[model samples]
Target: MKKHIIGTLLLGGWSLMMLTLLQSCDKQEVFSYESEHALFFERWKQVSLSERYRLDTVNYSFSHYVGVEDIEHQFKINLIGNLLEEDAEYKVIVVDSLTTATEDQYTIKNPVFRKGRSSDSLTVVVHKTPVLKDKSVHLTLRLVENENFGLGYMGYTDVRIRFNDMPTQPTWWTKEVELAFLGPYSYEKLETIVAANEGFTTFEGLSLTEKRKIALNTKEYISEHGITEKNGDPMEIPVY
Candidate 1:
């Protein structure tokens, strides 16, 4: 009876081990030939909006890379907004210029092992009904990895727009200030300005004379604009 019980336990353990190994092998096989690819898109800021009284035409330039070939991939675009609300109304038009190309010199329309490529350019127009007040709307584009036969990968981007007569201004003050202050300062110059600012200095002990000198210099610089000249230019002084 004891022998029989030992035999059964051994068999069960062996079966469990085999099953675990098989599962791991299957996962490895699935991802064995995986290739790295990425897709990205952004709205054109300069030409993104049209005149308030007219139809607004915009273009979104998309970029992507496929490391391998011979796989069929599908991309989908979705829009979400309150445009259909009782007080809001708008219409959208999308145009696709289907152009395909490979990153390599191999001009094969259809690739097998690691060949195949394509590019797309889309032109979109958003028309606001005269009755609708100007308002902001959000648009989202999603690229699903529909097929994964060890070929290219996938990614996506979502964009937001305001459909009103006036453009929406960004509410983040720090970003605006940073941009204004650093507009003329190179990274290196900004570093130097920060280092020269006494407020940024930390010492274990500051002598009375040293503190007086610092205070005098700060006052003189603020009153006579000496700091701006010493720093090379007002543009070189970082606001932060």
Candidate 2:
């Protein structure tokens, strides 16, 4: 009777082990998942950046965050410079000491988005040059698709940025300061003001809403009396 009972218990144990193995195999096959590939910058980053950084700014960095969440994955983020089309007034720099960065200058520190982390970053460094002071220059960078990952978002894939050591008036600077009692001034004029009295060199730090408030007042003033000088004389605004 004892031998028969022991045999029954052994058989039950074998069946339980087999079931566990089968379930493990099924779980391995059925519970698989694939995470999509996406590499992007945060939405707040300007799509096209144009600003005057302080002359003291040695290096300017542009970054894009990897959208992939895989821990064991390695990626290559290559920067390809898409130049400005041939125009007499414009300059083309395929590779230069002034534009293309050296190993010491620009580096991809950690392109790998390790396991368990959702994001990684790639940074491009722009070295300041005397040429940037004389004229504003821009370079366009496109994120090419690789075997590991494709370009993530349409809006963020291409980055076009112009940086200058000197304050080149921005395209947004439409109206005169005297008429608006507000913004929109050339770098040279700012320098003049600094030399003569007190002034802010750039409005880059100002919030967009704050900038808009000044613009609104300018518009209201113009609508009421057309743009007038401090002396109450009619002033001309350049369209170009």
Tell me, by TM-score, which candidate is best: 2
Candidate 2, residues 162-234: lDDT per residue as tens digits?
Answer: 4445544444344544344343343333333333322333345567565445445434545465545446554
Q: Tens digit of lDDT per residue, candidate 1, span 1-240?
A: 999999999999999999998976653422222323322232223434662321222221110101112222222222221112122111211211221121221121221112232233223233333322333332322222323222122222432222322322212213433353323323333333334454433212655455445434433444454445344654332332
- Provide the global lDDT of candidate 2 against the true structure: 0.39
Cα lDDT for residue 8, candidate 1: 100
Weakest lDDT window of 10 consecutive positions for candidate 2:
62-71
Model 1 lDDT on a 0 to 1 scale? 0.31
Pairs of colliding residues, candidate 2: 71-114, 71-115
lDDT of each: 0.31, 0.39
